[model samples]
Target: MISMQIRRLTMLLFVFVFAGCASQKSIVADKRLEEKIDQNFSDAAAQYKGMMRRLPADRFPKTYYAQTDKFQTGASSDWCSGFYPGTLLYLYEQTKDQSLLLESERILKVLEKEKNNKTTHDLGFMMYCSFGNAERIQPKPAFKDILLTSARSLASRFNPKVGCIKSWDKVKSYHGGEWSYPVIIDNMMNLELLFYASKVTGDSSFRNMAISHARKTAQNHVRPDYSSYHVVNYDPETGAVKSRETHQGFSDNSTWSRGEAWGIYGFTMVYRESGEKSFLKTAEGMADFFLAHLPKDTIPDWDFNVNQSGYTPQWKYDPSKFAEIPKDASAAAVAASALIELSQYTNKKQSKKYLKAAEDILWALSSPKYKAATGENGNFILKHSTGSVPAYSEIDVPLTYADYYFVEAMKRYKELKK
Candidate 1:
């Protein structure tokens, strides 16, 4: 009886040990799979790079500056002002070229001069690349001082009453209306500047403003299905919501694809900086709406409602000759990158859905339909991105932001394995 009891104990121990070994093996296999996927993504990025050679240094001098082009006249049009250097940073990462970083530094110097200016609504786009990322990566004392100065300048634009950044600096003016300060969906992206400023400067006011702005946007800008208006008006004194309108889309109510991308990416960034559950939830909701609405191949038309056959011009006097404008792949690229980040910040299963969607968009961008051939200064794929209807510029060419986000997505995918 004693021997039989001992034998039963031995068998139970053996079973427990075997199960433990199996669990350990499973975990190892899962890790290996992740590593393999990351390696594959990196390999793909490298392959893509081979197709586009290193940019020639002699073609455009280091100090060569592009014109102060506006996306819209009243608001700032220079989206590429900061993005130009950002593209160089991307190139620096890929090529380990010091020249690219030097060029980026030069752009920062020029922006330093314009730090005090608030006429442009695109301070975030202009400064984030020049100062925010630059300070983080390089961290020189000079850069820090310039960055701090720029942050303060940006914070001054924040109106406490509206709980958001005021932009579009005009009321319709060749005529006039109430001095309604329009808050654009793109402003959400610039909130990071406030958050970073607060952290570095130990200013609670800046952080508070950031949170308030995000909350206000969430409440007013988002629609029933989480689609958002491109432009929203708020009472400057009471912070009351006044109206919601679409600035970039086909109509006041139409769903602009790039504007939707801005909302998704911007809200996600807000959640990252604030750790606010509400921001994350709102971002996911917006992302879900976007993913649900995008047609197969993952790229969306400029406005979801605009049919190819029945598309009309935005203005009454505008000719209807060029109705067949290509889709905005630049916006698609940025949205894809943000979705991937959202996926990782959230979880694996959720992340995979976004990752897959981003991959589909990238695959589409790679095709000839969207991509442009290499030129002396134009070595980008993914063209036909619309900036503004009135200006009618860069309407069908590769944008700086498109290239930046494409590189960014590729970088994140590579990091996933490590």
Candidate 2:
């Protein structure tokens, strides 16, 4: 990891020197958007630099948590491939920061390795962060193989019988009923890999699979209110929806905050890429449900249905009995970024309302209760995160993806500045 950082920092320096010749005239004019972007990019770049500066000179084998002393320890890389690299690209586009580019490239290499592993359920989180973003931000013939390989790997996971990519293979040992195989909320982001692969390979099957999974989720996983379940059980052989379950939150019937956030963003992205009215309408519906239930500031508790007042009967509250209910600012930030994207795609006043909801969430994140201070144990920008719903782990800790989304939302605001 240190080597990766060093290589990235070096590349950034080179990019800085190379980008020095580019013009730096005012590219954006809306002051509010401009300020948000500037602050977000500043914070993101600082954190990336901080990670590089704090690392020890001695190299160590790169386990997930190996460089704890160097970077924030809470879920550093779990959901960060998209947030990290996406933020780096944002910074690069804004400041032409050579160091950021190098940093992005270094992280991209790490992403490529993970993409090749294919044992995990987060193909969207893994491949999108590395190759999907690489193609958009730093397109090159050399990166094509990495992107294609990653895309193919993700595409291959599409179970035709199920019409969705299976997630949670790592947890196959978990004692669950027969209705376990189906698409997950997190799989929404991974669909881009299938779409990209379709475009790359000229294979409509990949595109069809992506759409099929999304359509199925829309029908089964998302409730009439647009709030979504974490998991939708499927018949492995027939792609039929058997039931909806929540694995990482209060209960199978409860709404996991992050799961709803994923639906808001994921469905919105589907609309953007596919130009499907149904996707856009579903995105709007989901966003509406999420924003409606959010606190005044737009941040939400870890589980929307966790019965914050704790008045529900014990049997009805089976899951929360074992775990403390907490707020998840990371989910708010990610949802905010997605809403901002949706705002750009739509001209309706409702789109603007969604954008304001995201901004409100960002404001909440910047507050002392949510945002982390310098040199703190948590290197991430936001505080009070939850990694595992069942274990009740990482509560009130800073998360890398939280920081990443905060930065990404700010960047989106900046890009939209008139």
C-alpha root-mean-square deviation, each candidate: 7.5, 13.9
Q: In model 2, which runs have C-alpha deviations exceeding 4 angstroms?
A: 1-33, 55-83, 170-180, 308-325
Error of 2 at 242 (Å): 2.8
For the record, the alpha-carbon RMSD of candidate 1 to the native fold, in angstroms, is 7.5
> What digit string (tens of lDDT, one per residue) describes model 1 on residues 77-146?
3545666566566556656656566776755665566567666656677777656667767788777676
The residue pairs in collision within model 2 are 12-98, 12-99, 16-98, 124-190, 384-396
Indicate which candidate wins on lDDT: 2
Q: Runs in model 1 with CA error above 4 Å?
A: 1-77, 171-179, 307-314, 317-319, 323-325
Candidate 2 has a TM-score of 0.80
Please give the lDDT score at residue 340 for candidate 1. 76
Instruction: Score candidate 1 by lDDT.
Output: 0.67
Number of clashing pairs per prediction, in order: 2, 5
